[model samples]
Target: MNTMTLWHISGWGFAALAFAALLVGFSKTAVSGANTVSLAIFAAVLPARASTGVLLPVLIAGDVLAVLTYRRHAHWPTLWRLFPAVAAGVVVGTLFLVWADDGVVRTSIGAILLLMAGVTLWRRRRAESADGADEPDAVTSRAGRMKARSYGVLGGFTTMVANAGGPVMSMYLLSAGFRKLGFLGTSAFFFLIVNVSKVPFSAGLGLIDGRSLLLDAALAVFVVPGALFGKWAVNRINQRLFEQLVIAATVVGGVQLLLR
Candidate 1:
């Protein structure tokens, strides 16, 4: 047997990739706030641009599973506001990919993740004290539409750039009073469409090709079980605790990205 493999693929690299794939699948499909960990792990192992490209296909695979699992529970209005802004953000991110330097990319992604983490943590703390229970806030009234839009715009930009948008969008949905199924379903649809939309863009940029695609295929398999686990965990977890866990994961992920 060969002791070494191409790119050290059999060593820590594959192990890292596997772990990242597991997290990506889980975060994309269900637990929303686990994105920060996925981002850090993938970036650590792969080139930054390549990491996004390789991970997008795996994310789409997970999104497919999420859609299947949560199709009936989606809140259409939440998606309506979020998708358009997110699409616009993707356009902006594509432009950045075309022109920005590495420093710009790093700073932008780190900042966005940090901001999302901050918001998630702050809201969770307030919700804990104010409600004495973890309920989606009463932010969905007509009065809350403006607030939601504001959140949507930021979430779109962050997600488009780094796939770091989950925690951002998750906080919005939670604050807007979406409960478990509604939040999961809305996220499923949102990411499913967005990740699919990124295919041609990533290709055009040459971020994904033969090797990346093959790697994606292997990683996609993990997403199925990760997502299923997320769905099952959702059933047993307290709504408040679940939300808090996501937020905590988000904070950790965001900080790691920033520090890295």
Candidate 2:
């Protein structure tokens, strides 16, 4: 396609992408799993591989907004513990992209997300049964070095492959007993660093280019409103409801990806 043709998008396509971008901001600032909707929309609207590139800048913009809103509540110890393993996972995901087709990428990420959602739900159930209640401590143990590393690796790989890190990290944070603000704050920072790091790798792989950048610029404008809406929602939503919603979204998103 010509440059103009490549850049040109239909009204509905633009609207879909704009909504996806808004979801990015909302997910960053409030309900983390809502981003699965954004990812699915991007992949539907663009090539699977190319959509990740287009979404990255928009994610970073949301991350920046989230950081500004919840920077004070982040827990650095967990982030520090996860960094090395997360980096390794990113490398592995990068290597996978070298030979993997779009179908493989979609199905692989889908399966992973489904499995993770199952695990998170199962664990939560087990804890509730054991304690007769779903207390934070019962649901999630303290983040030890090993646990952090394992989740880190998974988070890195998923995020790198499909921008699906939010679910992985959300499960981890919930398990670790982080309340809403702390969870959002930590997630905001983690994604900012990771997404920025991926930029060079994506550009090198030709996933990012002038065309994608132009689209991202348009999408970025909607993120602010979404972020603002998220901030408002976060204050009112109950913890249990939030977690349940996230898990449901993750499962649905994974299924969509697999079938796509």
Candidate 3:
């Protein structure tokens, strides 16, 4: 498909894509896991396999904005420890993509999203039950390293397959006791690096092409306003309410994908 062919989407379809792109920016800055909704939207609108490629550039755009917004707060030690495991996961995800058909990919991503949502909910409840006790530092402990590796591999795989790494990383950071700025900062840099690295793999898979790039070009502009809005609202928004909304959206998106 050429550029013009890609423009053959209906007005409603384009609207949905634009909204999803906006959510990508919002998720990057304000809420890390919320873009799972955007993932669902893209997959529903475009071919399941191809949506991953098209959404990657948009995610990177948001990552850039996020890093710029929260660059100073990142903890480099954590990022370094996770990279090796993440690389292995990325390789595995690429291989899986090579063999999986559209139906399989769609169902797998849907299942993954729902599972992540459930995990997040469980973790949150557990933390609350523990009365938010101060846990050991995840950056320094041996156990922390083990946990990082586990989350790292999963994060890399989910991201490569479905652009759903945000939730996995969010859970890890929360478990590590990262405050808001630190979490956003580390996540921003992490995704910028990972998503950029996925470009060649996505292209090799025939998921990134002229047609997808054309659509991306049109959709990326919407991300800017969404990002700016998120930046402005981040400090003022009620954290509990915002988190609940994000999880609810994820659940809805997951159900849609599974039922579609």
Q: Which candidate is the best by lDDT?
A: 3
Question: Using Cα atoms with residue i matched to residue i, what is each candidate's TM-score against the true structure?
Answer: 0.83, 0.85, 0.93
- Angstrom error of the Cα, residue 165, model 3: value is 0.8
Cα RMSD (angstroms) for every candidate in the order listed = 4.7, 3.9, 2.3
* TM-score preference between candidates 2 and 3, better one: 3
Model 2 lDDT at residue 87: 95
Q: What does candidate 3's lDDT look like per residue over 30-125, in tens digits?
A: 977878889988888877777888899999999999999999988888899889989988999999999998888888888988988887787677
Candidate 2 per-residue lDDT, tens place, 33-122, comes to 678778877776776777778889999999999999999988877777778988998898888877787788778767866876786677
Error of 3 at 253 (Å): 1.9
After superposition, candidate 1 runs with Cα above 4 Å error: 1-10, 129-145, 238-260
| Inter-residue clash pairs, candidate 2 | 140-175
Superposition error at 46 for model 3 (Å): 0.9
What's the lDDT for all of these models? 0.70, 0.79, 0.85
lDDT of 1: 0.70
Global CA lDDT computed for model 2: 0.79
* Weakest ten-residue segment in model 1 by summed lDDT: 1-10
Candidate 1 residue-wise lDDT at 79: 75
